[model samples]
Target: MKDIVEQNYSSSQYIVLIFCRLLIGWHLLYEGVVKLMNPNWSAKLYLMDSSGPFKSFFFWLAQDKIILPVVDLLNQWGLVFIGIGLMIGLFARLSAILGATILGLYYLSHPAIIGADYLLPNEGSYLLVNKNLIELASLLVIYLFPTSYKIGIDRLIFKKHE
Candidate 1:
């Protein structure tokens, strides 16, 4: 078996990374729970309000009677699972990547188009970028570092064999 490579990270680095992980996880969990509890909640409006060149694709998804429900289920569950995984530092790399992917799709759906305004949650305004993009970047960083290997569940479960 190939030995697992260990990198030395400062305590401050671990603190900051774990903090980011927990915060992002909490955000995802909150969103998922909100949507899950609200029986009337639906992403239809969000999709319909999508802009940019991919507006039609999103609109199509919104209007699709068959696919919309599936999307909803997957979206909700995806958030919950990713949230739990990240929060617990279990399979964090996978969770982070998935989270980043979802965030990317969100950014693409609304796309901080220049001179364009969206009816999204009050995150203020931007010309060609937004909170989603920022979160995606953070997720990317999380994925790259694989903090789970340092101070997460992955560290406990998967022991390195020399």
Candidate 2:
């Protein structure tokens, strides 16, 4: 009975992990492709403008000019790399971590785009918490589980090892 239960649980977990990988991969792919196709679709305008929520923070960063070039490069390349990695399940854990970090930074910077005031009682404006939180959770889940093995290059590599 115990063995049967363990097998069932493992099977369920496998299904869930596969779903997660597909969901995350597709989302990243769409976002990266959109950004790549539209070079003008940059976070700088939304993030560093006066109308932006974190206008002060972004303005300060621009003024001080600390790591601007590195940040810019990472912002561009990181999205593409993370998207590709997730799509192919290559270094999935690392990709998830990097993706989560980028998402967290975006969340922190904005936080008032969604307008969910009931759940979070803030004075200024409501934050886009739901999608960001969900994405963050998904990334963490992918990091914890071995989703790459289900339908990814990791499976081929590990098969040779075995």
Q: Identify the leading candidate in terms of lDDT.
A: 1
Q: Which stretches of candidate 2 lie over 4 Å from their true place?
A: 1-9, 49-55, 62-70, 112-128, 158-160
> For residues 33-142, what per-residue lDDT tens digits would candidate 2 score against the true structure?
77767756655543554233565776565455555545655777787788777878887768989989987766665554644223322344434554666787889877
The C-alpha lDDT values of all candidates are 0.86, 0.65
Candidate 1 backbone overlaps, count: 0
Question: Could you report the Cα RMSD, in angstroms, for every candidate shown?
Answer: 2.0, 6.5
> What is the per-residue lDDT of model 1 for residues 30-147, given as tens digits with 9 covering 90 to 100?
8998999999988899998898999999999999999999889978989998998899999888999999999998999989988666788557868676889999999998887667
Residue 80, model 1: lDDT of 93
TM-score for predicted model 1 compared with the true structure: 0.93
Please report, as a residue range, the 10-residue window in candidate 1 with the lowest summed lDDT: 1-10
TM, every model: 0.93, 0.70
Find the candidate with the highest TM-score and give its number.
1
- Tell me how far the alpha carbon of residue 87 in candidate 2 is from the true structure, in angstroms, after superposition: 1.9
